[model samples]
Target: IDVGLQTKSNIGKQEAADRAVVNLETRYQIMNMVKDFVRNPANKNQMIPFDADSTSASASIKAYNELVAERIKLGSSAKDNNQALQALDTQIAAMHNNVVSGVENAMRAMRIQINQVNQMSANAGSAMSAIPTEEREARALYRQQGIQNTLYTFLLQKREENALVLAATTPKGKIVDHAYAQSHPIKPKPMMVLFLALVMGLLLPLLLLSVKKLLTTKFSTQDELAEIIQAPVIGEICHNRHKSQLVVKPGKTSSIVELFRLVRNNLQFLLTNDGDKVLLVTSSVSGEGKSFVSANLAASFALLDKKVALVGMDIRSPRLAEMLELQSLPGVTAYLAKPGMNLSDIVQSSAEVSGLDVFVAGAVPPNPSELLLSSRVNDFIDQLRAHYDMIVIDSAPIAMVSDTFSLAKFSDAVLFVTRANYTKRNLMNYLNTVMSRGQLKNVSVVVNDTNPNVSTGYGYGYGEE
Candidate 1:
């Protein structure tokens, strides 16, 4: 509605400008015509001497009257005598006729000249007379134009004033009073929004928790582990903030260390003969604490006075050497690449745990799968088995690489590590596949990085006893 009003105002102003332009043009034309008429040479003939012509004719008639009076006196004086009087009368008559003829001729010429002058005066007067009518018409037109200009100017001014008023004020609208909260908010209801957010903050976690419990198949507790896999969970390692891979120490009494002790003790039940058990530790994916569990489990076994060898079989990306702070060179890749390389030359002792030994992945090779499949690797494992009581091999993620499958063949058992809330449930399909194919033997899951909130259901706690 305001737009329509503004449009109308603008149109009116445009029409005003157009009318002003036309009025100015007409005024210019009228002024030009008046100026041309005033400057015209023919109109100057209105000053013609018609009165002077009449005065000249009157002077000639007076002179003729004086001559006639003179002739009449001569005739009157000679009329008493006989022949002389008659002759004098004839002479006077002749003179009188001559004077009369000259006068008449002069008067005729004056009349002709006066008539011509009068006609010229009349023509000039007629032209001049038309001027007043033209002037009146021009004035009337000018007055009309002025009036129109004034009207248009007034209209334009009013429009401008209206526009300014519209620009300065808000539009009128129907008003009604309604109930509102006291103390109108300046920036919005920040406190109210915060309270609502706090409520959602309290409820959102419970909602997500319920959804996770209903929709997910991933195990979060020991009961879930026992129910799904139908196997004993050797250990449940809590989440650790340690930067190193080997979390277990000989004298450390941390919950993680105690958990590893429990796992080492429970691992004995899974062994049939316990003659140098070769355990392969791997996960379906990386970052599930597979390497952490392998190194710590070895450290735990070493604390048990059993000679333990922790081998980094994941040549693709080795972290055990760096995690244990040992030299990565002269290890598995080098031992396997060189013909007749002794296992003792590659094996390095761990300084943290007295009985723990570590073999790094050594230099990265292009084909880790092929290297692990080589006959030399089997011989290397066998030699390590003869030397160490427990050979815990930290292999590559089974889901990502085939290195673990090759290394798993000579192992006595495989401990699959899965992190709670980290490892996906679909990995179970891959584990079941490997088990069904006979590629894995005596496979057990070690649920690593379990949340304490979830472990509470299984009565697991890390508090000091």
Candidate 2:
């Protein structure tokens, strides 16, 4: 309502200012005509070109026309030195000066009126700014009154209902049996209690296990995950028995390393492009060891003497540098944000693995998705492709944020990571939906942290032992 009132008021003010401007323009036209008459009296028309629409200038134009007509008649009938003609010339000069003064006065008045209207508009705007707070208070009061009214109505109805029930109710008493006292106590039979206890002990374990199985929402095995997702389970990584997150180090032959090697092989087969391959490694959610998988997988590829560039694309929560124990230097974000930054300026060599360069996620940015959405990100990937053979991008979880989806377009293939017994089973259903909709390109799954016993059947220790 306040806004409507302000708008209506401003419209009125604008119309008033427009009228003043029109009146001012009419005065200017009158002044110009009088000046032209003074310059060329003979050619000046006896009937002035009067504007019927200009009410403010009508009287002045009439007087000027009369002066021009008297001068024209006297100049035609009498000598140039005649007194009447001279008198007419003096009157016409006075009228011309008057018109000039009127035009200047009209201009000044119009300026004053416009400034007044602008001041009023400023006042109205100030009032409008204060309306929101007043409106909020009014609405709050209205809501409180409505709540009270509803509560009072409900209580009144409930009171009337109770009164009606009381008026129609009847008192009746009946006894099913009389209270009695027993001579012996019941509930303390020793042999019965012992037998029940033994029965409960026998059934408790089975009941607990059944409930656990029924409540299992996460996949506990690789096959359980593989059965749900439409994509192939490229390979599975066993649970790392060691404390260090990096397992595929130099001169290491652990089962985890061997499994990563297998995963690496499967990824190589999936990306069949002749030149550089861009692989996006992400998970349904965090804490699924995607960073660990990314670091180790890159190491595994580096072990094959392939030039691998591991980029930490997860600018939201960058853990790749910390996990690799590398100094947190400027990385992909710098390359995307700064035009002068080169790949060598941000790329740091991995001390733990040779032939592998780590691109830290750089400083955590506030707008990670927008940064990745930049066209420079594609150029950054192309730069990596030109330099390295394999570009492994460890991105954010697909289910949690949109940063990965923006990076997905630049990848040749996707390596979706899921941890066994840690990742929810429903995530595979979501992944299947993503694959069906073609949101990701050439998608594959890599199950991380599976039970060592379940994964050892593939003979990870074929010749090491």
For each candidate, the alpha-carbon lDDT, in order, equals: 0.69, 0.76
For model 1, how does the per-residue alpha-carbon lDDT over 327-399 read when each residue is reduced to its tens digit?
A: 9898899999998778778889888889888899999998777787788987887788778889899999989
lDDT of 2 by residue, 1-465 (tens): 676877567555544544444444444444455446445657443444432223444466567756766676556567878888888878877876665455445546656765675566456445445446776467447544654555456446646753544333322434689999788767688889999999999999899988986798898677877778899888888777787787888788877778888888888888886863899999999999999999999999999888999999999899988888887868788888888888989989988889999999988877777888888887898889999988899999999998888988899999999998899988888888888888997888988888876664244454221
Model 2 Cα shift for residue 45 (angstroms): 99
Pairs with steric clashes in candidate 2:
none
User: In terms of lDDT, which candidate is strongest?
Assistant: 2
Clash count for each candidate, listed in order shown: 0, 0
Lowest lDDT block of 10, candidate 2:
45-54
